[model samples]
Target: MDTRFLESFLTVAESGSMAEAARRLGITPAAVAQRIRALEDEVGTLLLSRAGRTVRPTEAGSAILARGRNILRDVRDLQALAGRGSIAGEIRLGAISTALTGLLPTILARLLAAAPMLDLYVVPGTSVELYRQVTEGDIDAAIVVKPQFAFPKTLDWHVLRSEPLIVLAPERIADRDPHSLLRSEPFIRYDRNHWGGRLADSYLRRVGIRPHERLELDALEAIAVMVSKGLGVSLLPDWAPPWPAGLSVAKIALPANAPERHIGLVWSRASSRIRLIQALQTVASQVSMDPIAG
Candidate 1:
């Protein structure tokens, strides 16, 4: 069977749309459909069913999905191992929202400059979901908050940055005490569902202060906006910023012992994309070493 045909079939199966798969593969929808038909003929089975704009794999296609991925990965690995061509292929990378906004662009620029042929497919997701995707091999790697639990043996992690937690309060508050303001003012609680949120929660508990909870949300920028509007003060990591413009808020430092939120890359050791991951790691390390000035 032609690898190109198999690739097209797999792409269509994953994307659920021939047009989307064609766009990703840099081919026309007609070409993608032709490739899928060729693949179906080679396998002597009906592989997909179309409904409107979407396409789903048939039982035969479903049965071979994992094997097809493995085959394609193995072929790519073989090419890399043989030094047959330039390092070029799609890399699916998962990342958290803050990292997407704050850290990744510089690092990505460096990586692209070094490997001009490489293609990156970035998927934005929460840290928890990114970690799961990394472990499950749904992505080549992920940039996310350091996981709270013990690391499993199957994955490797590297720290990229350590961000200190800080209190964000409206500038007009007369009292400057971090703890006092935290307790007295209405609190815009960080959503407890996030790992960083849990860290903030732990800090509050350790200090024996219970905030007057007003609202709980996950977006840092939105929370900053709310605080600027005098809604309530918030506890958040002083993550890399192009913080909201004209926000009238002051960042109050936490005590010396406050937990730091560490962002890092996590990847499966068994992945075929180890070389790409290594290249990304090098770029990330360089970026971390020489952070860009705001």
Candidate 2:
């Protein structure tokens, strides 16, 4: 069977729109339709049904979908094992911007060196967006903050790092208490929209400190820069190293009970790219333990 046809069919099934699948595969909608027709003809049954602008698999298509995925996975596994463990395929990975800046470089270098034939496609997004992409099968894996609530049963998470929430205060501030400083000084808030930011917010609420709000921003380095200039104090994670340079700010630890931000890799358990994800896990393990990440 033609794997290209199976892949096209799978992409369309996942996306629910021929146009969207075509965009993902970098092919025309007409070409996608032609391939699906060819596949259906080869199978001798209607594999899909058109519903307005979207498409859905028929009973036969549904029956074969799992089999088709297995076939694809087996083929790639055979190639990888037979070729001295050289993984050769395109993998789309999504990551939060913080991971892109702070952690992904070392992991990417190691992964590319191990599998030179692999084509890596990186998509930068927030944790929420990356989680959606992983769930929808748009990306094989993602590096993001672990959700506070229960995650879907279909996914697996591997914790890479746990960073404590910290207070960033200007050197001029004499106050040592995180809560007191927050209540007294102008606050450069970490944007509450992010998962990490939510951690900070929850901690603030628990500590009963309503900060004197001055600004709400997302970028960690930018927040560090702002605090360094004596703009305001902000609560943020003391994430791994390569921090913003020459920042004259004091990093104050929160009370022992404050929640730490957990960062890790997340992926669908049924994905065929298990080997690749394992490779990523290996690299992340090394990076997390490395002094540079601290």
Candidate 3:
């Protein structure tokens, strides 16, 4: 089976449009359609469901999507391994929103400068989602909040940053006690669905503070904006900077024992791109040490 055909199918499935897939693959749309048709014939099943401009994977296609990704990854790994001691080939990296906005640009810049042949494809997701992606071999590695649970032996994790939880309040109320403000003021709750947010929730529970709940969402920057506008105070990780500018908010310190949100890198132990992964790790370490990165 031609891997190019498989690539076309996966790209089409991901983009939900053959034209878009063709654009990404640098091929004509008609050629992309032909490749998909050939792949469907080879696989002996209809792989996509088409409706006007939109496309979706059929049941059969969905079943094979993960396997297809793995196959392509292995092929790429083989090609990279054949290279003459140079880090070359794509790295499918997943990152949480904060890491994407905060640390990723520096890491990417240094990695590319050191290994000019390397290519990158970045996926933005929550820590939970990125962890799952790494475990499932969908991505080479991820920068994410550390998981509360233990990981399997197939994966390796390393802590990159330890962000402490803090009370985010408008400057006007910055003088108020953190716990008292949480209990008295309207609360903009961090989403407990995310690992970082779970830390905040666990802290609130441990302190026995049932805040006057006002609103809740996952985006930390958005939460900050709300706090800046005096919508409510929030408990959040003091995430790495480049916060939205002109926000008049204060990061009030939590108690000495407040649970910290650990941001880290997780990767598959079995990935053939270990050199590239190690290079990325090194760059992340350098960035973490840089005072301006915070």
Candidate 4:
């Protein structure tokens, strides 16, 4: 059976929309449907159920899902193994938004320079999503905020940076107490759903400061812009820089004892792309040592 067909089926199943799967695969919807039909034919089972625009996996499809992923992973591993001594082939690397903009570019530049044959496919997501993807082997590795919980033995993690929480406010309010500003000003809250955001939430609770919340979001750079426009004050990690330029915002430092947000690399220890991942880790380590380098 054609693995491409299986790939198409899995993509469609995950996305829940044929058009979306087609778009992601860079193919027409009709072509995706054709592949799905062919796969179903080969398997002698109906693999999917469709209702309106949404597509869901049938019982058979659901049963085969994990095995299908493993099959594809093994196939890719064979391809990478074919290269043997060379650090080549694609690495599906995920990163949170801040790391995507601030840290990944530097690491990618150095990594590609050292291994010109290496291909990188980057997936951007929240730390929570990226962590899940890494755990499930949907991606080889991720740059993300460190999870509060201990990692299972199947994975490995390395700290890249430790960003401390800071108050983001307009220059006009820069002089006010960091905790006081959070209580008085319209607060542009960091989304509590994220690991880093949870740190901010914990700090707020510990300090007994309930912000006068005006908005809640996950994007730090966008939050900086909002604060620059005097939309409200926010509490966020002092994430690696190249922050949005020309923003008249101030990053007010919290007390020295405040909690920190640790960003790191997380990857499957069993990935066939371990060599490439090691290369990535080396470059990431170098970049982390001198964050301003690119």
TM-scores, each model vs. reference? 0.79, 0.72, 0.88, 0.85
Q: Which stretches of candidate 4 lie over 4 Å from their true place?
A: 18-41, 44-53, 58-60, 291-294
Model 3 misplacement above 4 A: 1-5, 15-46, 51-54, 63-67
- Top TM-score prediction, candidate number: 3
TM-score of 4: 0.85
| Tens-digit lDDT track of model 2 for 9-113 | 988887899998898788899999999999999999989998888799999999998888767657665654554455676667888877887789988998888
Residues 1-294, model 1: lDDT tens digits: 789999898889988999889887888999999999888888899999988877999999999999998887777666546542555766788889888887899889989999987878787888988898788777889999996787899999999899889989999984588888899999999888999999899999989999999999999999999999999999998887667899899999877787889999999998777888888999898887775512
Query: lDDT at 204 for candidate 4?
Result: 92
Clashes of each: 0, 0, 0, 0
Q: Relative to the unseen true structure, what is the C-alpha lDDT of residue 240 in candidate 1, on a scale of 0 to 100?
A: 76
Backbone clash pairs in model 2 (N, Cα, C under 3 Å; residues 3+ apart or in different chains), count: 0
lDDT of each residue in 1-294, candidate 4, tens digit only = 898899899889888999988987788999999999999999999999988878999999999999998888887788778876999987889999989888999889999999999977687889999999998889999999987789999999999999888899999878999888988999998999999989899899988998888999988888999999999999999888789999998889998798899988999998888998999999999999993732
- Candidate 4 has its poorest 10 consecutive residues by lDDT at 285-294
Residues 187-250 of candidate 3 have per-residue lDDT tens digits of: 9998999998888998899999999999989999999999999899999999998899999999
The per-model lDDT (C-alpha) reads 0.86, 0.85, 0.90, 0.90
